[model samples]
Target chain A: MEAWVRKLVTGCLLTLPVAASAVAASEQAVRVAVIGNSPPMSYVDESGKLTGFNVEMAHALCATMKIRCNLLPTSLDKVVDAVSAGEMDFAVVSLLATPERRKKVLFSKPYYRSLSIWLSKPSIKPGSPRTTVAVVNGSVQAQHAENQGWKTKRVTNHREISTSLVAGDADATVVPMLTAVSLMEKPSLQALGLESTVLSDPLISGDVCISIHPGRPELREQIDAALDEIKRDGRFDRINSQFLPFRLL
Target chain B: MFTTSRTPDNYRHKLGAGVLLCRLTAVFSIVFASAAAWLAVDQHALLENMEDLQSRTLPNSMEHQRLARNLEVLRLEGERVLAADNPENRRQALFIVTLMAGHPSLLANEKARNLAIETEIFLTRAAQGSRIDENIRDEWTRISRHLSLTADDISVDGINLAREDVRQMNGLVEQTRQKLHGAVALVLGFLALLLLLIRRMILRPLQQIDHALSDLRQPGSAVTLPNYSLRELASVREAIVQLHGLMQEHESTRDDLQKLAATDVLTSLNNRRHFMFLAESELTRAQRYGRPISIGLADLDHFKHINDIHGHAAGDLALKAFADIIRSTLRHSDIAGRYGGEEFAFVFPETTPQEAVALAERLRAHLDAWVIPLKNGGHIRLTTSIGIADASAQALEDALRLADEALYQAKASGRNRTIQAKTTQLPLPLGGHTDNSGHSA
Candidate 1:
């Protein structure tokens, strides 16, 4: 009877190795949710397909790091909410990695930089006391304007702020450099003037970065590693060249 | 007997057509002005678009050319670095090489460093020989090859970017030109259409209306006109028709007013002033032709009783009925009218004083027999007293005084009765020759 029990235990141990190997080989395919929406950042196309510069970059990084990335199409506000709630693994939207947002989520190294431009009515000059700045709601830009002792009117979206400047409701608006550049080229923008002064203070410096859920140390390490690899292999330059023409870079 | 005429209505219709033409011409001018404004705006937009395109593309083209020249210079400097000699020259070469490597066109730092090292080694080997050595020459050849490759990469990248920029600028310019051309065409087409519409809808109608109006201004103008195509213009034509009708009514009213001036409004009889004028003319004709003329004055007896018994409306009815009785009693040649409130003067041509007295009696009897119905369910009976006079040079004033006195006598003798005074004896005095005791005969 003792020999029978010893045989059973050996058999159990032998089977455990096969089961463990199967579990290890399967590797529990991790489902990582990446926030995507803004152009040249993360957006879904009319075909319900995920695309854009940040989305493509994220996909490339995920493939290089051997991770399964699921793009979550969401607005910039929702992206911040999802990352904070740990519902998403990370965000690839063009969100400025400000000190305020840094408190809620861990920000990777800045992959892109954009200037803060002053958009003014063509009849008005920047820095004039009469000029009023408009910024999107819940944006760091509004906070930066407030810090600079500049009065700001918060708008619901980028389009509303641009239209407010065009229609002469606001004398000026503050926007990301690329959007300002694109708007300046429009014929309707003849009624607006772009300030040459770039807001490069750290308070206003908009560095677009990937935001990760806090305490996801393992995932953060993997993403950092992949980002470093992408930079080293010149893939970052390739991605930037593809998207730079669409921006002020 | 009465005769009808057509001159008044025809004159009125002509006046109406003239007014309509003026109104139509004003509407045409307003529409033409509006179209001109739209064309002006469209033309301005076209010119602005062209100006915007020129301003956007020209500077970009110039900037691309400057960048292309800078890239060419950098390429030449890279070639010169491979051709230098000596260790010191090579060290100098490295510094220049570093400068070239720092250019944005250089792809990667490693690639730039590798090219810099290879070029420096080639320069070092080349310096060992006074004449060209094969090994050094081969290294020089390799360095040239690398330099060529680098130049190609730089030129390709620069040219591709420049080409893309130029293509975009060209596309914008072409689009602007096309848009300008389209705008100009649209403005011209709009102008043409405006002119056509002005001519078809406005000017032509106005010309037709002008001709019609001018014809209307002339005597005996025709009322017919060509049908206006547009509804608003047609309504104007209809208004002209209605105006013609109104003008006809106005002319008829004027003629009626002329007639009314000679007739008394209350009794539809000749007024006193008009009656006297006609009587004088007839008296002159009678004197010239030696024909007999007679004049009579008739006054109602106790006429104030009619007004006191009933209201003014009943009084008016009584007066109208009395006048009607006298009118029916007179011959067509005899003229009768309300001389003053209750008094009437009549002039009869070719009649004696006795004949005038007989006519007066007939009028008095007719008025006495006539009874007028009142709105108050009562009837009014009236009577007139008469005085007859011959239409002679010195007796006309005496006749009117006698009739007035006779009316007073009829009232005093008895109410509701008529009396007559002869043409002689200066008929009873104004108050029956008033006595101190108010006696009556």
Candidate 2:
């Protein structure tokens, strides 16, 4: 009788979390990829944890859908690649659905877009052949500048590109205007008396959408439906208000 | 055979078409070139717009979302600054707020940028003082909320702008496509016109000329040259006609000149040079065929004395009368010519020396009986001296010398008589007065 009781206790202990997991799985399960280095979207904070607009938005969406969301933090490019490879269920990172990328991954409806702005030292002219521009490596800005035949200095991040511009390694840089604004407030920039001006009339631009692996048709439908629901129910607005100055869909 | 030494006219215009068609072609070429260049420029502009959409405007819209996030982060950071219990946490929050405040997208919006600056200033002051009292927190809270709202407005404005950009780009693409289609149609139309012009105005005329030239080349061809419609081609046809006319005129003139060169203008008979040429050819024929040939020398009797008595006009009339008599008396195959001022020579092909003497005697008798009525209404009687010799192959010169000696003998014996040279080696006859002229009184 004692042996049976002990066996029953162990069985119960094992079945409890399993039953909880099963229940959770039956409700909904999603692995969401978020960029770890991109600020204002998703970034690793001082605590070395994924936290940003996209990360928070993902959590909010999971809460609304009554599902379990596993957030995967990685580089922007890897996040998209991983989601397309089915290593993650879907990516919440700001990824563009260009025709080339669409061949590899299925994309959700566009959630956001960006405008390109020119950043130059006060004295340098925008788009001059003699002027060297710094662009973020692996960014649309880099491709745009290269296509224009502009002399380019490549850097790993937007801040580094701005820093190259401020350090006189580049005469100008092309970045998202919002990212440039954040770099402008750098203490090092202030100390060096380095200033940058945003040139008017944007050069090139892109839009962002959630990407999914090609085989996940049910998940894609669920996401699309959930997104539609949030948008209709004002939950999306609420989430957007927490991060964006306006609603994004 | 036909002959000419003519050269084609020097032409200044290089084009095959006439001046008017050339001018039209020039105008059309300019129009086509201008249109093509315009199309190229328009295509380049469309490409530039596409580049702008891809690199600048679309990216701007996407970054606008980031801008909204940054502004939200800033507002949250401000809130955190207000909620911080410790100075270090408050300082970190303030730092982030300051960074977001200077953001480029925020700076682009006046209201949002101003509010952000205000919030940054407030946070900086609060952080320095190491205190965020209740009233100060409330002020920070109000500013943050306003900033968030303003930023939201900016985000929505940016999205609208991006959509507008897309709409304009679509319209531009359509406009460009339509323009390109029109340009292609225009170019094709012009090309077709050029081809038709070549066939009608240039090629057809050329083909006609080609056919006319080929017909002209055929033996005994009488085909007329075709006319042309194009001015230049018409001019070419006119030139060819004029050249043909000139060639005909030249041929007629050449015939006249040749006749004048070989004939005696006064008597319409072969001159001394032509007579000698005929005699040489006869001599050659006699040698080759072993045929007998006879030659004779004749002279008008007392021709110089008559000239001295009757005046030069009467002398000329008498000489012309003698030449007419000689022409009437000679056989069709026989050759006669004025040897010099008053001397005549004859070549009777296939006739013996006896037959030639008989002909000479007949000629002398006819001249002796002839009478010329002068302009003065007086009759003048005339007579001739004749000598005949048998000419064999390769002995024409010797024959001629013998005949001349015999004629001198006859003139000495008495004029108006015929004499025959017996042989080429015979001495001159002696029973006559010496008269240097081959004539008698």
lDDT scores in order? 0.61, 0.71
Give the poorly placed runs of model 2, Cα more than 4 Å off.
Answer: A1-249, B1-227, B241-249, B424-441
- Among the numbered candidates, top DockQ falls to 2
Candidate 1: pairs in clash? A37-A42
Interface RMSD of each: 18.9, 9.9
Q: Candidate 1 DockQ category?
A: incorrect
Q: After the best TM-score superposition of candidate 1, give how far the Cα of residue A14 lies from its true spot, in angstroms.
A: 24
lDDT of 1 by residue, A1-249 (tens): 999999999999999999998777656444345444334444467898876577778887788889766666665456677788887878766678887788898888776565566656545555568567888765667777787777777775565766777776777877665555445545565434333234556665656778888968677777877876676455765675565432111
Shift in Å, residue B201, candidate 1:
99
Query: Candidate 1, TM-score vs. the true structure?
Result: 0.32
Deviation in angstroms for B215 in model 2?
A: 10
Instruction: Give me the displacement of residue B288 in model 1, in angstroms.
Output: 99
lDDT of 2 by residue, A163-203 (tens): 68667888777766445444544555444433333333333
